[model samples]
Target: MALRLKSLTLASFLIPSNRNDWDRHLSAKHNRILIVDDHQDICASMRDILDDVGYEVVVTGNANDALEQVDLTPFDVVLLDYQMPDMNGAALLRIIKQKQKAVTAFLITAYAGSTGAQDALNIGATAVLQKPINVVELLGYLADAERA
Candidate 1:
């Protein structure tokens, strides 16, 4: 059920607020990735692609479920949709960081311009990417953590 995406063409992965600060968040053991998105299709598609790449992927369709998972498991990276019915991604990201300050998180949104990428950066997110994401570019961006 993997959907091929071309949104990478938009080049919507905004640059990190600060390169050194972003690199400070990376670590060597970054195999586990948690994806929180209201859209089940997006969750399933990302899980499929990331799973195939040897990542241990866990995905949830809402904020509550994501929080439950966060409380129980330690994830290396978290990808959250900027908007969800239960809670916006920033609030969720803040809570997740409270529980595990070491997790590298990213905000995923279709409305990047309106989603407040700076707020996400201030809340400890590594980056913000628009929807229909380029999994290849995501992998490349995350590669630093893997190689650290």
Candidate 2:
């Protein structure tokens, strides 16, 4: 697969002043994150968001590929979208936890207030984030996960 860069508006997520802040709080080894989302733009946007902040970011448009990436890589954390065409995030998290119990995972979704959040958490998500994720909250979670 080819790795392509997406053009994005950086200001929408990361503040110029805080761009280096994420790196300051966490090292590159502890900052790797895998993002699984069916929407190409969302995946690209998130990849850019984390990448700009100095974290290694990997993204996949489907659950199958995301699973393969997990098996092949050693990501410290994952931010998985709740909805997808092939498989739901909860199912993916279950498989990941079964394969690697120590892996940290978080389910991200617009349906955060719904039962899906509970389902994902019950399955194995270390945490859940409401969609249109708050940057500060996400950074806080990543920082905490880095320490753990």
Q: TM-score for every candidate vs. truth?
A: 0.77, 0.80
> Backbone clash tally for model 1?
0
Model 2 stretches with alpha carbons more than 4 Å out: 1-23, 26-28
Clashes of each: 0, 0
Candidate 2 has its poorest 10 consecutive residues by lDDT at 1-10
TM-score attained by model 2:
0.80
Give the Cα lDDT of each candidate: 0.75, 0.74
**lDDT (0-100) at residue 119 of candidate 2?**
78
Structure candidate 2, residue pairs in collision: none
Q: After superposition, how far is residue 83 of candidate 1 from its true place, in Å?
A: 0.9
> For residues 72-139, could you state the per-residue lDDT of candidate 2 as single tens digits?
97778888998999998988888888877877788888877667778777776766777777777576
